[model samples]
Target: MNTQDPLSIGIVGLGNIGRYHAEQLTSLMGSFDIELSGGMDIAPTARDRFESSFGVPTYEDHEKLYETVDSVIITTPNRYHEEYAVSALESDINVLIEKPIAHTIESADRVATAAAASDGVCMIGFHNRFASPVQVLKQYQQQARFGDVHHIEAKYIRRRGVPGRGTWFTEEAASGGGALIDIGAHAIDLALYILDFPQVTEVSGVTRSIFGGRPDYTHLEMWGRSGEGPFNVDDSASAFIRCADGSTISLDVAWAANRPPNNEFVVQGNDAGARLDLSDGDLTIFESSSAGAPHFSDSEVRTRDDDPHRIEQQRFIQASRASEAPTVNTVEQALTVQRVMDATYRSNERGRAVKIDSEPLPTVD
Candidate 1:
């Protein structure tokens, strides 16, 4: 495939996420050199919907779609992530895999190892890092304007946004650990990214199945039909993470809670601090100036609401074109996130803070 030609992109798992990628890629067609080669899914309804909605070919299996694309995006359930991602990397096809890396640490390692060895580029989908607010905040941190950033408070809670019962999201075996692995992945990645991926030392966490597991749980205008099937996964979680650099993170995420929705992230630094909404991209910076009288200052900065998904897709195309691994949002970073999650679960089980191993993460050469 010539780099000059548009990159042929295929999507596995034509569900809501796959369709979302299709929408973002279409918007990028006029700007970036990309072509939606096709999509693959086993479900007839999903395939039919994707084919009709995007006017693209849909496949029942990956092999057929693999032949026509230069790159692939895997948006399948957590457990199936390794299957598609590893296969695509083995084929020397560039890959953009959605987060949590895989369902478990073992599975995530397999994906990371494959990404390290493969000739093709592999970038993890930690799209929130591309949001305007995060991008701007990262610039300030990079410039040393925020001094030594030491802590972050990340929140991504929903008032009553739990998925319907019996869906793959509600299944422990399929979705991994529920809210922790779902939204928690985003919060962890953003916090670490803001801190420049320092070595994690330990994690203390508590997970609760509070609302979703009950047969008597009230729907009250929540997602999908409530009280239908088994709900064994957690609905909310809280965790604290410590890093080798002495930086820290407090994570709070949920699919369903009694309080109103919250999507805020606060980064605390020695000289300055920053705050942003994870979903809305609103940003505010905090600092104290002693130019005249000693006083504190808070300034709000607004930026173009460029869709993070679209920016992520654009970067993936650039990586695929160069056949080089992305410098940021690498599979290695995603694996680190998986490690934190694994430790958090262990911490919950042991009722104590879990120490993370100091082993080096796999890196692409």
Candidate 2:
């Protein structure tokens, strides 16, 4: 493979996100020497729209796109993540699959196995890790700024924000689960990333579908194609996780809730604590000084204009060129997060804390 040659990138699943990926990739071509090979989407309307807008070829079959591109971005729903990702890897093509990896632990495991055996690069699109505040938090952890971390509280709640009431998001079979698997994947991955991907020992959780079946429920924004389908997934979820190192994490997420909208992660440590507001990308560090009288200090940390999705794509291309899997977005780390999510649902069903037996997979240096 010629490292200097421009990489050919293709996208699968031409939905809103897939189009956004195309836009970003198109914009990046000016800076990074790359080619927009083409795209694939099952929806005929979507394929037509994408081709007409981007002036790029669109394929009905993803295998045809895979045959042309050096790397592919898998942006299909959670259910199709594993199938497409595994196929791409098996074909010796690099892949960047969206979050959660797969809809089930079994599927995630198969994808992980394929990634471990493949020479091609595989990365999970946990783009939040590239956010400026999140990048700072990870740096703080590395610098030991948060001394001996004990607990992390993560919440990604939206008031009246149900995505496509009748779409695959509301269907358990298509989406895997509800709020936990959707937005909660972002929350859980961010928390675990900040904590350096701790091994979860146990998980206790509860899930509810209070708003999905409500036809009278009103919302400001509803995403996806709305119609009438199975609303058999949870709209809200809460969970408590215990890690092997004795640290813990409290997670709360919902697509629609009665409370005020909240998207933040608070890390509590012995020496200091920090809060990150995901909405505006602001980070606040809290510390107490014991001089004379105990005084508290709250300092807001400034962040750069970091576009995480763009950064994530650039890094993926770089990693593929180097023939190395990214440490932050590897299949191993995503498998750990997926296992935690699976345990949360199981714990909810069992009405007890579910013990986690899956260990964290290894990452390449």
What TM-score do all the candidates reach, one by one? 0.96, 0.97
State the local distance difference test value for candidate 1: 0.89
| Candidate 2 Cα misplacement greater than 4 A, ranges | 359-365
The TM-score that candidate 2 achieves is 0.97
- Which lDDT tens digits does candidate 1 get at residues 1-365? 78678899999999888999999999889998889989999899999999999999999989889999999999998999999999999999999998878999999999889988899899989999998888999999999988999899999998777876668888888888789998899999999999999999999999998877766766567543444446778889999999998999999999888888999999899899988986677899999998899999999989998899999999999989988789989887898899999998999999999999998888786
For candidate 2, lDDT tens digit of each residue in 37-130?
Answer: 8999888999999999899899998899988888999899889998899899898889999888999999999898888878899999999999
For the record, the alpha-carbon RMSD of candidate 2 to the native fold, in angstroms, is 1.4
Backbone clashes, each candidate: 0, 0
User: Any residue pairs clashing in model 1, and if so which?
Assistant: none
Candidate 2 yields a Cα-based lDDT of: 0.89
Q: After superposition, which runs of candidate 1 have C-alpha atoms over 4 Å from their true positions?
A: 219-229
